[model samples]
Target: MPLPLYLLAVAVFAMGTSEFMLAGLLPDIASDLDVSVGTAGMLTSAFAIGMIVGAPLVAALARNWPRRSSLLGFTLAFAAAHAVGSSTTSFPLLFATRVVAALANAGFLAVALTAAAALVAPDKKGRALAVLLSGTTVATIAGVPGGSALGALLGWRAAFWAVAALCLPTALGILKGIPAGRAREQTIGGAALRAELAQLAMPRLILVMLLGALVNAATFAGLTFLAPVVTGTAGLSELWVSVALVLFGIGSFVGATIAGRLSDRNPGAVIAVGGPLLLIGWPALAVLADEPVALLLLVFVQGALSFALGSTLITRVLYEAAGASTMAGSYATAALNVGAAVGPLIAAAALNTGAGSLGPVWSSGFLIAIALLIAFPFRAMIRADSNTEVLQ
Candidate 1:
């Protein structure tokens, strides 16, 4: 809702694009560096690993620092990393830069999530988070594609340079827009660190985090291999893969936007209704993989349901971790990345079993089914406010 929130979203767009655009640039990077495409793919894994480790580490280190300064520092660091990465001829150097960039990106996102929630009223926290996360969805729709096109027109290095250049204005905007002294003044010392760490023992908090991770894992299990599903199974041409991706991205954007408004009022209802639809959509997609038209439509529908449920779970994390520590945002970020790291691995295992494109879809279905079971008994707990008595 606030201008500062939008500015954070802009920063997110730049970082998000850098995170995902590598998918298109991997071939170029691999060929230029004399590495195989599979090796180049590790760059994505490196980023994911960095994000998982960095969110909590960076957030803890900067817990005493002002939010505005932390954001600006991370943004600039990310830009610098990209600049170095683009210029590097050495694969090892490029890989190191990817790790560094991911660290900066994770730090920025962790702080940005907390800052965005702080920028709004308690009741508006969900909407604020939605607005902040919409940047990533929009990145999926526009920024990633734009980066790919830039890579195609110029060179892969050009796309990196472009991301670096975009960050300068984002840094300037953060400095201009975010107010000073907005850091976690309440958690400035050793006691605060202990308090943050102690959150790991809270059953309710852990449950929410687990749910967030599981839902995200399920979403990615299918999402990562969508190209094969669109082309190999659906009998579509290569061009249709891009169309399928765009349709999914559009659905994600819409779902997240709507879920933000709804989750604030009734997160339980949002999850309860969306979860079943998501569970069913995965299997339905797998069953209809041969039907090009159905596959395309289901891709869109599945994206909507996946993000709708995923965003609601993330919003729930905010509330569940309320008043615990500023590290709450770090917890959410880490959970999501954990899922991002694990989902594709599970899907890969399924694929190894000769399941073809359908492996990922079934894998997704299995994961969501488990998520629903975990959340079912906890529905009352999820719906209850953090300050209220814990539902048994």
Candidate 2:
């Protein structure tokens, strides 16, 4: 990894924190701003929608710009958005700020991943990407939790202020650290690149991206509905519910870090392990909800393993989607953005009948089991690479 990589990872950390910490601070925000919880959640949806739209659009628009400049430029825009978000009490004003911030954040993500891949060797791309994505994990473990605590103690506005504060250091870090350069034009431009994407490799790679998205939806569909399930079925205290959420975040962070390393060593093994872990964990999660301690344990592991699959999928896509890694990376991020957007809605629909949220969890469990059967397409693609002969 290079200095540019380190700086980019910092940007990812700040971006991840700004994106997710809002979830933890929602109760405070809604009450303080005189809006309902459902309305404040629009903040989360706004970011995902922006990310979905920006992933491809920004990736294309900035395709020709220097990566370092794009990252620096987008990051500064992101910082300004957060700064604006912190200063506002008006719901509509904050809403507008969130959209702009999210767009900047999305652009930064698409370009940064492409830049990170370019900084490392071919065989090391997985490892390099793992290292990069780990920034998000670090945010899950440290930044989001810390910001949430800060918000709870001070004010919800303080959380956005905290995130906005990071911008100054992040800007200075990226400016000094990221290297200046570009990939070969052949890898980035024109019909030849489109032809490369048309090969069997690219479709399989995008399929892997979709599978990654679906798995996230499957897990979150259940997890998002868990609080209601716990209240109605498990009869847990609000304190324990918060604890459970923390456990899940911790597990996700740990899972991503370990999975990145493992995938770099062998992506097939990580994918193989991730699906079964989710398949087995969800049943235990549902069956043991009565035992708050036990169910939280299972759910933690499930959350962790689910995203470990994501880290591996990242490596696999870059490898298979060669010559157009940036474009492919944009699509992959779009899948994730779509999943994040849709997961809660699916859970809400399943839980709407006053079925104690059990319906959503069961629905999620069944879907993941089906998704496991579909992962073979990606596994087969990676294995195909093993069969190619050395041309030298």
Candidate 3:
């Protein structure tokens, strides 16, 4: 709703592109750096590890800083990381840059989540968050594909340079848009930090964060291996892999749009409806992996359901953590990246066990089932919250 929110989303777009575009450039990077593709793939693992560790750490360290300055610092740091990465021929240097970039990206996201919520009315927080997350969905649709094409036309370094260049305008936008203030009225100190960390042990907050992580794990499990599923299982051409990804991205965008509107009114309903659909969808995807038409259709449906449910869970984490001094956004960010890391690990294990391309689908189903079971007790709480909102 606000211009600043859009600017934050634009910054997220640049960061999100860097996060995913590397998937397409891994082969080139490996070749240039005199490493195997598998080794280059560790760059992704390094980024994930950075995000998981950096979110809360960075948020706590920057808790007392002016929000605008912290945001600008992270954004510029991200751009610089990419610039160094683009110039590097050493694998270790490039790997270190990815970690640096991921830390900057994590800090930016953690701060931006709180900042976006701060910029909006209480009732509009869901929509504001959705606007911010739309940047990632759009990156999946346009930025990753464009970066891949650039890498194909020029070189892998070109994609990194492009991401760095894009961040320039994003940094400028952040400088212009975000207001100078701490995330909260009360600044965090030693005791405050300990208290905020203590909040992580709260049962309600832990449940919500776990739900968010499980939902995200299920999502990435299927998505990380979707290309192989499309080609190896469905017998499609390489071009069709891109088409399937686009379809999934489109579905995610649409699902997130709907979730944003509905989450504020009734987050329970979003989860209630989406959770069962995903439970059914994942198994169906596994069974239909060999059917081109069915696989394509299910991919879209699964994406929509998974993201709709995932977004709602994230909103719930924000709600549950709202009382934390400064760790609310960091908690959500950490939960998200934890899922991002764990999901693919599980899927990869399944594949290694001779499960073939359908391994991820089955793995997703297993994860979603656990998520649904975990969410069962939360229904009463969610409904009570919804009722209170309606009464207010």
* TM-score against native, each model: 0.82, 0.79, 0.83
Every candidate's CA RMSD? 4.0, 4.3, 3.7
Model 1: lDDT of residue 99: 89
How do the candidates rank by TM-score, highest first? 3, 1, 2
lDDT of 1 by residue, 196-299 (tens): 67877887778878888888887767876665676678887645655666777778888888897888668888888999999999999999999999998998
Total backbone collisions for each predicted model: 0, 0, 0
Q: How many backbone clashes does candidate 3 have?
A: 0
What candidate 1 gets wrong by more than 4 Å, as runs, is 1-6, 22-42, 66-69, 86-95, 113-133, 148-158, 175-182, 185-187, 235-239, 386-392
Better of 2 and 3 by lDDT: 3
By lDDT, is 1 or 2 better?
1
Candidate 3 local lDDT, residue 80: 94
lDDT of 3: 0.80
Judged by TM-score relative to the true structure, which candidate is superior, 2 or 3?
3
Q: Model 2, 304: alpha-carbon shift in Å?
A: 2.3
